[model samples]
Target chain A: MSNWVLKGLQSGVVTTRYPRKEEKAQGISPGFPDIDSQGGDINGREEDVCPTAALYGDSNSLKLDKGRCIHCFRCVRNTGHPVSWTSGFEWASFTEKGTPFPKIFQKSLYIRVVDSGDCGACLNEVKLLNNPLYNMHRLGLFITPTPRQADILLIVGPVTDHMKTALRKTYDAMPEPKRVMAVGSCALTGGIFSSGFTSGSGVSSLIPVDIEIPGCPPPPLAVLHGLLTLAGRTK
Target chain B: MKLQETVNQMQSRWNTELKIDLDLSAGTAVVHCERNTVPPLCGWLFNTMEYHFTGLVPEEGTEEWKLIYFFTGEADLGSIQVQTSAPLNEETFQSVSPIVHAVDWHEREAEDLFGLVFEGHPRLGDFVLHDDAWQEGLAPMRSGFDSDLAHSQRKPKSNWKPRKVLDAPGAFVMPIGPVFSGEAESSHFLLETIGEEIVRALPRLFFKYRGVEKLAEGKSIHDALLLSERFAGTTAFSHALTFCTAAEKLSGGQIPERAELLRIFFAEMERFRHHIGIIEGICSSTGLVVAASQAGILEEKMLRLTGKLTGHRYFFGLAVPGGLSRDTDDEAIKEALKEIKGILHDLNTLEKLLKKTSSFLDRLEDVGIITPQQAQDFELAGPMARGSHFCNDVRKLLPYGMYPSLQFEVPCEREGDGYARLRIFFEEARQAAAFMNQAAAMIKPGPVYTPYSGGEGTALAGVETPGGASWQWLRVDKNNRITRYRIMPPSFANWHGFHLAVEKFAFQDFPIIKATLGLSVAENDR
Candidate 1:
């Protein structure tokens, strides 16, 4: 035990200085593709290449829905006319029903995470927040075991048939002044496993989503941005 | 046993009327037989021939249902696939679970998804589809079933009760999950105990089943590869490699040497991180917060290194049908090798500290024991079986990619306890790092991608995942669309025998035992 303590001291602090300062870690995210203005006319072939149809429309107008993108890189890497790729992890956004929490509840917030039917990647990124590097507890955010004491509900996965009831019951158990944040592409637009025989397209179909963080499985920093945004800490 | 000797014994003892197609180059044999002869043949192969019953794949046909029973043994025997057809009118097939216990869950999954009945199988319903949520006769995997149709949700059954195995005084059943507090996947467990010690352990998983195999029926090879990796994200690269290998076999395409070596490198990297995550789980379960945090930090570093080497942290969108989608430069490979070596040094230091912590050892040593015989009976895979002295590794038994040229040891322990499993994890992680270093040195300058047009054929491929040997069997049409996609993940094989380690343990030991096993619900549920 003494040796462990000494080893801990030797390792020192590895926490990131986010919110106060931007996290400039390389390879922290698999960034999404953005249509470059200088590129030639869109042949509309790139839209068809997207397996999830995140990119659509013709040469007249092109659209990229980040919510539906799983960052497969087909549009940027495999297409003849490639789109420019941007590398930054802050991808969280406020839904129409979203607003920052009141100042009273800003200091501390309890989160209850639900796995509706995720493939496991999204949930894993969420788990990384508790690691020593991310250290979400330092930001006044915690993972509560019960929904009754939770101030926010964090969900991942496309809502599956079996988990639908449990997800709803968790929401109902939460107290007032509660918010729901859906993480990953599956939670936002069902990514690949869209509303099929077994699942709803995303979390918004069953519950009102306050925040949306989009990626195949958003990196830990992106998830941290979502949490801080809910607490009204991010600019 | 030699492949010819087994083939000759089958011909003489069983039926000479059977049609056999031998592919000696691929070391595979396909035997076409009657449906009535399946149980006997599977029993003979499992008991007499001592072949491992890999999985059972159920295929939908125009007028009938086809069942393919897979078996593999030592490299000499390779793999034998038995194909038989049953008419649509006959819903019942003889169960092989009574003789080969490993086929128990496979048969149950078929019954739930395809609405087939396994005769003489004691349990069938309420497996994948929960009785409270899904209506009977849904049969979602049928070809005629519409995937886009919306089905109304059902209310929980008021009369439903869990299966009870103990009726003694003061005995009661305790239910655990389907929903956990943290980021753990949803899985339920019912523990039946009379006092502090549990007598029966019943696990109910698949609450997050997304019907991945059914969704891949009409998808192209590219889209199907995405589904394979997403089904279980932790071991994403291994599953993708398995899918691509199966597809490549169908097209008969040759992979570049550089691509083959890179595949091994990325695969070892994934395995290294996965074992570290398991170590974190074990520490957390034992109430060692500092050690758990230290393990978590190491895992994060590994993930970042992986993302730096391959664009995605989990290796998504990296593996393609013929080869890799992108290439890593030699400079990047050298940098990754250095980082991995440093990580291994720190891991050794942590291991040394952990060994001295008596409190940690007391919790893990001699806890959650599974005997060697039990492992063989259940046909366990990966570290769980290795801890019990079952030394069957897919990389060794069925060599593919660069494994035939690589050097590594499949570590085993005779204790078959939590501590034994932990030691194997540390040892395997070291071996994985060594493999990555060797593969990095073997890398050469070459093309990484080879394009192959779709072809009509059926093929099976297996890869050694973090959990164990995961096999993907695929059948593609001439148009490059998948007709059947079946995944035999290691978790599904090992989950069948999890009860062996839990039944005789105290209730407090459940979480530790579960963490040590480290089975993924997403992999099994998919």
Candidate 2:
């Protein structure tokens, strides 16, 4: 057991220098589809290829809704006129009625994670934030068990029917200076599980979403961006 | 026993002439029987013939409801499916749970989803859909039920209470989750105890049930594949592979050689990462902070490696009907194998230290024991059953992909304790790494994708996932649109036996025991 301490000390710091320095790891993110500069008309075939309707428009104009894009690469891989793919992890954005937390709660914030009906990928990525590499502790972010002590509510999954009340009750229990961050494509636009019988379209339908991190299951760095954005610390 | 031999014995013993259809290539025999003979047939198959009851798939027909019961034994015996039907007017059917205990949850699930009455099931409603959240009669899986329209919320059942069997002055029930700290998925547990020792444990899961099967009713094969992988994200590639194999079988398409080898490589990679995550969970549960963090770092490394090799961290959208959606570069595969070898060396050092740690061993040695007999009775799958010396691995028993050609050991432990499960996990991770190395070496240049013109038929495909054997049954129309899609995940089978390990253990041992089992709530809930 004493050797474990030596091993730990010898290994040194493996944590990413994110928010302090850029994490330039290759293939760290699956990336989102952007309309290519040499874009052609959005024909019937192009519009119908996406499984989630993330890419849709008339012949004159095409739209890419990053919230609904699961990064299936259908548009980029299977179409005649491909949408250019952009690879980076800083994809968190503020919602329409969303704002960053106040200055007082910026340095130290407690997060309450709620799994409304996630498929497990989003939650897995969220758990990885606590690992040695992407240690959120160094950034003054900690996960609290209860909502009363939490200043941020980090939610994953499209809200399922059975978890509706639990999610609502959890949101209501939080104090006034609370912000909600929805991670993963499912939590943003319900992704593939959208409009199902048992699940709501997304978390925003049940509660106001402050920050949106989109991907099928957003990579750990992207989720970190969401948290940093919530704390008003992201560059 | 061979398929024909079993059929002849059944006909002679029951003294009933049965209509049988055999597909030699697929190694399946379909036996049509009356509704009244369903119970006796299932009993004869399970008790006398020693066949393992796989699962029961209920399909809604225009005029009747058809129940397909899947059973398997040795690899040579293949699969036997008993087909029976009930009139639309008559909703009740005989329950086979009393005779075959493994059929309990399947019947309860069928009853909950289809509103079919299994006459002798001990309990039915409130299995998947909680009575507090849903009305009693709303069978979501029925054809008449709309998949798009959200039903009205029902009033919470004020009088609803968890089932309790212990009766004593100090007896009390403690409810554990639907929402837990950390990244644990939503699942509730009721631990009934009079003291530190728990007398009974009732697990109430499916708080995250998104009606995966119901949503897949009218979807095309491409769309349904997305649903299959998303339902359980940890073993995304395995489920996708299973779904693709079923689709391939239905269309009579063959996968290329290189694609098959690549499938095995990716599957083992997924298993290696999954077991590492489980090891991390066990370490954390036992309060070994440094070791857990080390394991977590290894897990993250594997995830990043997977993301580099395949576009997705979890190998979603990589598997399609006939073969893989995209081909992996051989140079990249070789490089990844080199990195994996380094990780394996570190894992070996960690395992040696963990074995010598007396505190960790003390907590795990005999804390939660599930005997081999209990494992068989509950039909537990994956490492959970292997830890109990069941030696039931789909890769060996029902070889798929390149498992038949590749050599690997299915490790087992006689002691069915938490320590045994942990050891099995480490050993399996080693074996998975070996498989990845071998598969990478065997890769040859070939077309990875084959355009399979979808045909109309029903087929069953099974794959050895990290958790266990996950079977997918697909029925498609002429237009390649799915009519019915059924997924029997390994976690669903293992959860039935989870209570066996938890019931007699102390309160403090619950988390460790659960960590050792490493069953996924989302997988089972789906």
Candidate 3:
């Protein structure tokens, strides 16, 4: 105990200088998967190995609905496309009419993390926003604890039977101009639990899933990208 | 050496068919058995030999329910998960609480969520969902808890009160809260006090029944990791790591050595920051601003580092199926390590100066004392557990990740009080520094992650959380989709230890007492 006090006095301020633009850091858990629907091979590998049925199969065309993508990287890991993640943490949006989507934007967006039927790994991505390194506040992406003040509801996990009601209630609790963005594979198409789900599936079946960010647990950066889309803050 | 032999002998003597399984692909293992046989096996492990009951994880299954008990060894990083099979009859297995005092809350929780009844539980009264609200016959854990039924029957929380002491001699009782101040989620505490000392501190949990366990049902083990992380937000990495380890082992996923090293690096960072944050919180509760400031700065620093390494301060998405989400470049890793090193140096000095401050010492010294006997009886873990003279560190006993290779010390004090707990955290942070530093130096340059697809398998993986060991059992059926996912976090076990501390301390010491005990509602509720 005595020694601990001594150590404390010596440590200096360790907070990050975020919005100040002191570092080219993209914040934690950032990811915006750029799947060139036009790139056939990249799409082929991604479609072949995608653990969840998130990637849509079309004739000579690759379509991606992030709302259902789990970002497992299995698709990217198997191929030779630049899979490097962008750390741009600035993500948020606001709308008085339809719900927003997760995208990179300069104005920032307020996202409310709702644990519908999530495994907790997805919830961690939502939490990364508050950390000093990503400093969602620095990018105007504020995490409103309650749904009322939020525009984009960051949904994690598939909507389990028990959570289905809670998920609806949470959305209902939020102010109108709300958009639902499913952040993990669980939230999109019920990714892994689709058939076995004892209750409901993704937000689309209940409310409306505007965008999906899929990954076993989407990186915080990817989560940021999802939020950016809803806010129309994405480049 | 002796312990291992004894464990092996017991495994043979019991004559239980042991189908050894290692999910080499995912880096995990499984040992399955019948549900009813778990207690006897655990008894042999804990008493006949030297294995300890680390945790009991329950997963939601449609046809049947699966429960796995993780046991730790004396040496070797080996862990055994006892898988017990039971038809979903809603019958609670006999309580292991009598054998491992840690299971008191675990059994109670099982009863509340799974609607399983532990017939012989010494105090099987409601620990979470009130006894009156849910009858012994009603199984809240069943798959049939329809939303319409749940909502239509959304019975209010139990007003079930403890045995009244108000009419007794030298005994009076009062309930603390379902709602509290200062960043605390809702929870109720009932105190039975005699004079100034507390006689019994009954913690009434499950104020916010998030139904996390029920929710993770039927999800693929990989996807379930997200839900596991949510079991407790502050220590999401531990749950995710633990769950992934189980899945990896079940699937025989081969984990790269480099990736394992990265896991340990981030894990240690998490341990340090959380310990610092927790202790600093303790200081703040006592109005020791200077100490609090020191701890706050360290915490803020840690959260910042967490953000940098994994891009989400808490390190989410960092732990995928087979490995981490990404690998740090050499230079980047060095920079991060250096930053941590610098803060740790300062933290060391700050600890010293604060100790010199008389005001801080007066308030902390002898504030909340838990004798060695009480400590052992309660079977506490983490700093609080160590503060009580129990030489139990799951990290050492149940080594995980690169911990078996890393050399570190487990700090202990016999006092078992708020001050001693705080001291243990301080010592632990220092020790963590050494461990993290060594890990960074030994880290081999290579891929930090390995992509793994699933197969039909199951696993029981575990990671040490600030609270204690977090266990997540994952089962993937023939289709490679997750069939069952169960989580057992340390906070569940810590409940018993917390009750011991609370029941003995004064009522006003509630804040400090709760702080010292350090149970996370979000984690436990999940």
Candidate 2, superposed: residue stretches over 4 Å from native: A40-48, A58-61, B148-150, B153-156
How does model 3 fare in lDDT? Answer: 0.63
Put down candidate 3 lDDT per residue, B25-119, tens digits, no spaces: 33234566665566776776666655556777776566767666776665542556677766776565767777766566777767766677676
Worst 10 residues of 2 chain B by lDDT: B147-156
- Cand. 1 TM to true fold: 0.97
TM-score of each: 0.97, 0.98, 0.72
Clashing pairs in 1: none
What would the per-residue lDDT of candidate 2 be over residues A134-162, giving only the tens digit for each residue?
Answer: 99999999999999998999999999988
Better of 1 and 2 by DockQ: 2
**Model 2 DockQ vs. reference:** 0.66
Two-chain complex of model 3, DockQ on C-alpha atoms against the true structure:
0.12
- Residue-level lDDT tens digits of model 1 in A126-209: 999999999999998999999999999999999888898899999999999999999999889877888467866899999999
Q: Of 2 and 3, which scores higher on TM-score?
A: 2
Tell me each candidate's RMSD, in Å, in order: 1.7, 1.7, 7.4
